[model samples]
Target: MQIDIRAKGFELSPALREHAERRLGFALSWAVYDVRKVAVRLYDINGPRGGEDKCCRIQIALPGTSDVVIEDTEADLYIAINRAVDRAERSLARRLERQREHRHARQPVVEITDDDSAEEFEQRADAGVFH
Candidate 1:
């Protein structure tokens, strides 16, 4: 999966980017759905009055579903990213589980007739109505 890292007030370094990727990748690897890409944004809250000011936003793309985005602000950027990624992972897991359950629930059950070689069954098969 592709990881896009962007910084607002500060320049993102190779080490930081790699660290974030490693952390996020580990979390997403356990997901049931395949992740197409992850986008992370880092920005420092400019106001002195805002407590827990560092902001981290993460967007995750999964198969057959809309992208999930999580935003968290904390005193530390790493903490914020970790929390946001954790939340995103949990949400994705729940969604994937629900989808799997729905698919199973919607499946039609096939029942075979008692007389395996009956003429009616043969006729149904010949008519392409039963297999």
Candidate 2:
């Protein structure tokens, strides 16, 4: 997966970038096949004031589905990144699970007998016309 990291309101350091990349790679490794790209935005929401204002927003682009976006805020940037990555992993897993369920939930095809057509059988079943 292609990962893009952006920092706002502070300088992006090599150590921070490496840490974020490593964490994201590890967290999202299971979804690499589905995920096309990942965008990570780190920022100091409170600026020099420093509170629980370090924010990490992660957006994952998946093929044939809506992108997953996760945001986390904490006092430390690493914590925020970790939380956001974890949330992203969970969200992606849920999405994939739902897709799999939907794919498997399709109605089974039934062969029509000489006495009844498929449509008629369905209609009868809908009208509670079982024999």
Candidate 3:
């Protein structure tokens, strides 16, 4: 998946950007085929005066399905990113699983009828065809 990372209210360091990308990539590795893109935004809510005001927002795009968005805030940006990624992983799993179940539920179920061929097959089976 394509991942884009950006920061607000502060400069985004290479280390931070790399951290976000690595964490997100590993977390969603199982969904490579299903995921189209990932967008991450980090915010320093407290600015110079810090006090548990870091925010991490992640939006995941899935082809042919609704997007998933997850957000978390913590005293440290790393913590926020970790928490948000965890939440996104669980939410994405549930959404994809539900889609799979829905597709299966929509499939038509075939039924057997009392046709001549079916009757003949049944008779042969009753006679133990090979016995």
Candidate 4:
């Protein structure tokens, strides 16, 4: 997946960029095929004031599904990123599950075969052939 990391209101350090990249790479590895791109934005809400205003926002792009967004705020940017990534993982799982369920529901539950008799085919069609 493509990852775009940006910092707002503060200069992004190499260490911070590496940390975010590594964290997301490991966390979302299971979704490698499903996830297309990820954009992470870190914000220093208070800037110099510095109170628990660090924010991490992550937006994920998936094929055949709506994008997923997750955000977290904490005293430290690292913590915010960690929390946001965790939430994004859960949200992505849920969205993928819903997508699978929708696709499954739309498919026909029974298939016709040439070996089947007319009566059997009708019965199978009337009441789906469930395993």
Most accurate candidate by TM-score: 4
Candidate 3 lDDT score at position 45: 91
Looking at candidate 1, the ten consecutive residues that score lowest on lDDT are 108-117
37-87 per-residue lDDT for model 3 (tens digits):
999999999899989999999999997887999999999999999999999
Per residue, candidate 4 scores C-alpha lDDT tens digits across 38-69 of 99999999889979999999999999767999
Please provide, for model 2 over 8-127, each residue's C-alpha lDDT reduced to its tens digit, 9 standing for 90 to 100. 999999999999999999998988888899999999988998789999999999888889999999999999998898999999999999988888887554555689978899997787
Which residue pairs collide, candidate 3?
A: none
Say which prediction, candidate 3 or candidate 4, comes out ahead on lDDT. 4
Instruction: Report the lDDT tens digits of candidate 1 across residue range 70-130.
Output: 9999988888888988898888788778888999998755446777667776677667675
How high is each candidate's TM-score?
0.78, 0.80, 0.82, 0.84
Model 2 CA deviation exceeding 4 Å by range: 107-131
Tell me the TM-score of model 4: 0.84
Q: lDDT per prediction?
A: 0.82, 0.91, 0.91, 0.92
Inter-residue clash pairs, candidate 4: none
Ranking by TM-score: 4, 3, 2, 1
Report the Cα lDDT for residue 112, model 4.
61
lDDT at residue 77 of model 4 (Cα atoms):
92
What candidate 1 gets wrong by more than 4 Å, as runs, is 47-51, 113-131
Off by over 4 Å in 4: 112-114, 117-131
How far is each candidate from the true structure, as Cα RMSD in Å? Answer: 3.8, 5.5, 7.3, 4.1
